[model samples]
Target chain A: EAGVAQSPRYKIIEKRQSVAFWCNPISGHATLYWYQQILGQGPKLLIQFQNNGVVDDSQLPKDRFSAERLKGVDSTLKIQPAKLEDSAVYLCASTLRSGRVYNEQFFGPGTRLTVL
Target chain B: AQSVTQLDSQVPVFEEAPVELRCNYSSSVSVYLFWYVQYPNQGLQLLLKYLSGSTLVESINGFEAEFNKSQTSFHLRKPSVHISDTAEYFCAVSTANAGGTSYGKLTFGQGTILTVHP
Candidate 1:
């Protein structure tokens, strides 16, 4: 089975510029997530989508970041007016619906965003 | 709120040597614990998980972790290491959301970089 897929494995942008990352989850997966991983730190959940609806986005920076999963299959995360602190890897993950057994998440090769 | 802590930033060990990576977590409710491995330029892969029942979980790759509820710790260990085992190990925890909209929103710890030299 194919795993989660992401685009533009690497990206570079200047401060104040805008950048966007894309993610296509595994087939039949019902849940999708976006995470940010800074150097030396674990990936932090930025937002979660259950189908096309948002499940959680408490940690997301609404002032600069936005994400959407219109069809609930692919997702896009955008950062406007990027700052130097936004330099980090953006990871996307997906999982099947929760059942009696716990669902395991599969991740994609993240997009390494370098904001100069 | 929930949080995970990886005690070590980096660990260097010779090939065939035993190694352990320590993790501890804090949470108010019941949680599911997991260990993920990320090779250079790759995505995170599940190493193992502890949801319930047995406190000890083992991965097919000779890696094992024991979940100690009393101590709130889950430490990954391997009897012998190989150069291929070098990667960043992350510890994470998740719990069922009260609203029932999601189940796997994970809170991760700062990762531990394990370098196995051959």
Candidate 2:
């Protein structure tokens, strides 16, 4: 079975520029997630979508970041006026359900964003 | 709120040697613990997890972890690691919020880089 898929494995942008990353989850997966992993740190959940509806986004920076999963199969995360602090790898993952090991998630090759 | 801490930032060992990666966690409610491994330029993969059963959990690759409730720790250990075992390891905690949506939000620790040399 194919794993989660992401686009533009690497990206580079200026501090004030805008950037967007894309993710296509595993087939038949019902849950999708976006995470940000800064260098020297673990990945932090940025948002979660359960079949096109947001399940959680409390940690997301609304002022600068936005994400959407219109069809519930693929997702896109965007950051406007990117800051140096936003330089990190953005990972996407998928699971059949929420909050259970039986629904273990499979992650994608993250898109590394470098904001200069 | 749930948080995880990995005590070691980096551990270097020769192949066929024993190694342990220590993890500590704090949470307001009951939680599930997990260990994840990531190879270079790759995504995170689950190694093992502790939910409600036995305190000891073992992965298919001969790696094991014991969940210690009193110490609030879940440490990963391998008696004899191979060179292929070199990777970054993460400890994570997840909890179901009492009032909010029932999704399990995972909090991960600063990863530990384990390097096994031949």
Candidate 3:
């Protein structure tokens, strides 16, 4: 099966600018996740969706970051007025179930964002 | 609340040498453990996971991790690694249960970069 897909493999922007990243998870997968990975660090979960409903968004910066999974499928993440610290890779992943024991997550190639 | 810690930020080793990457996790509830590998310019791929039963799990590519409940550690190890094994590895934890409560949201550790040279 094809893996999770993402667009805009790389992006460069200035601080205070806005940028968006898109993700298309594996067909039929019900759970989707967005993560931010800074240089030399592990990916941090930003948001999670089960179908079209948000399951978690505690780590998301409500001031400048937003994400949506429409129709329970494809999703997008936006960082508005980006900060210098916003420079990182945005990753998307999908899983067959929201349960921890059911299935493993499949990930996309990720969008690398650089802010000046 | 949950958190994961990887003590080593970078580990360099020669081919055919043994290596270990240490990981510790803190969680109030029962949690599932996982190891993920990220290749250059790519996203993370699941290396292995520990849910229940055995405290040991092995990945296809000659990697194994032992889950030590007492130590609260899940350390990845390889007896002899190849150059292709070079990559960044992450350890993550999430509640064992699913649905509205846990959402299976993963909390990841600071990654460990393993560089294998010839």
Candidate 4:
């Protein structure tokens, strides 16, 4: 079975510019997530979606980051006015369960964003 | 809210030697623990997890973790490590929200970099 897929494995942008990353989760998976991993740090969840609805996004920086899972199969995460601190890897994950429970999360290769 | 702490940021060990990576978590209620491995330039992958029952969990690669509820700790260990075992290991905790939904919002530790030299 194919795993989660993400676009633009690497990206580079200048400060104040905008960047977007795309994710296509595994087939039949109902839950999707976006996470940010800074250099030398672990991955942190930025948002989660169960199908077309959001499940949690409390940790996300609302002012600069946004994500959406329109059809619930694919999702996109965007950052506007990117800052040097925004340089990190954007990981996308998915799971089989769509319920209010937890399951094994499958991750993608991730998009490495470098903001200069 | 839950939080994870990896006691060591880096650990260097020789091949065929045993190594342990310590982890601790803070949470009021019961929680699920996980260990994820990230190789250079790769996304994170589930090494193992502990939900209930047996406190010990093992991965296919000879890695194992023991969940200690009272101590609020889950440490990963491996005997006779190999050079290929080098990677960043992340400890994570999952807890239900106010609405009691385990939405997969993992609280991860900073991470432990394990380097094995032959």
Residues B7-114, model 1: lDDT tens digits = 999999999999999999985457788999999877899999988789999999999999998899999999999999999999998875544333678899999999
Could you give the CAPRI-style class of model 1? Answer: medium
| Tens digits of per-residue lDDT for model 4, A24-46 | 99999888989999988888999
For candidate 2, chain B by itself scores a TM value of: 0.92
Q: Give the per-residue lDDT digits (tens) of candidate 2, residues B1-118.
A: 6779999999999999999999999845566788999988678999998877899999999999998988999999999999999999999887755443335557899999999999
Return the lDDT, model 2, position B35.
Answer: 94
Task: Quote fnat for model 2.
Answer: 0.60
The estimated TM-scores of all candidates read 0.95, 0.94, 0.94, 0.95
Question: Which sections of candidate 3 miss by over 4 Å?
Answer: A98-102, B97-102
Which tens-of-lDDT digit does each residue in B1-118 have in candidate 3? Answer: 7889999999999999999999999845577889999887667899999877899999999999998988899999999999999999999887754332444778899899999999
For model 2, the stretches where C-alpha displacement exceeds 4 angstroms are: A98-102, B97-102
Error of 1 at B83 (Å): 1.4
DockQ-better candidate, 1 vs 4: 4
lDDT of 1 by residue, A10-101 (tens): 99999999999999999999899999999888999999998999989999999999999999899999999999999999999999865644
Residue by residue across A16-53, what tens digits does model 3's lDDT show? Answer: 99999999999999999999989877889999998999
Q: Which has the greatest DockQ?
A: 4
Model 2, range A1-116, lDDT digits (tens) per residue? 99999989999999999999999999999889899999999999999898999989999999999999999799999999899999999999998754444256688999999998
